[model samples]
Target: MAGAPIYSKADLARAETYKARDYPANVDPAIETLVREMMSGFADKWTVTILDTLWDSGTLRFSELARQVTGISQKMLTQTLRRMQRDGLVVRTLYPSVPPKVEYTLSPLGMTLGAAFCNVWIWALENHKAVDDARARFDEAE
Candidate 1:
């Protein structure tokens, strides 16, 4: 850790200015913990897409599922499947075959969450026009 560039002049001055701004000294402990916990449960687009795909089909081969989802690479698809399996959102099974066979299906928890996602998506579709108008207005503002 020797010569690790400890606090260059610019960095030290930025820290001082941030401190001088006198931002809120404290946040509600409960709100802080709640926000952290809530945010930690968030999933990105690819993960949600995989989950949604599995929800649409009870079980599917890896390649077939990838076909159903647009613009997903084999590497990314495999990685996402493994992560979902590790998280207990998906169950991956391998079958012996001349070319090797595999299948993926949602676990109980995955199904539950998938159902929730479906509801949220349905609501979005139902309000698509409103949302589209909002987006249009937002872009115009920008």
Candidate 2:
């Protein structure tokens, strides 16, 4: 946490190659491609982490989510979940309690992307040693 950036040779190469691609403004990535990319990164960012946690746990109380993910403020998580709901990536259900109850889960469409996330999870579990080794090498380098 104290020092240099961590990236593998392949990571750096992909970064450069993606930067090198030149497509006209009219040439957009396919929707499926974009969706797959997002799904694959389901554990990499706060918003994605929120989604992936929900994916694994099924419907979860709103407070339960806030307690699990570190460093996410209540307002921020609420906003992210709202956006996912709007985008059809998540479903929100509210119950009329004496106070109120709210739960969140994946939509059927979201379930379709679960396999993509599962693959990323499996790869991360399998190759985290490589990631740790890269971090060590990076920290030791000039």
Best by TM-score: 1
**Candidate of highest lDDT:** 1
Error of 2 at 112 (Å): 2.7
Inter-residue clash pairs, candidate 2? none
- Model 1 over residues 36-66: C-alpha lDDT tens digits? 8533544556788888888878899988998
Poorest lDDT segment (10 consecutive residues) of candidate 1:
1-10
lDDT of 2 by residue, 33-122 (tens): 875766554544876787678777888888998887778999888888887787687889999996799988989877766667688789
TM-score of 1: 0.64
Q: Least lDDT summed over 10 consecutive residues: which range in candidate 2?
A: 35-44
For each candidate, give its TM-score against the true structure.
0.64, 0.63
Poorly placed runs, candidate 2 (over 4 Å): 1-44
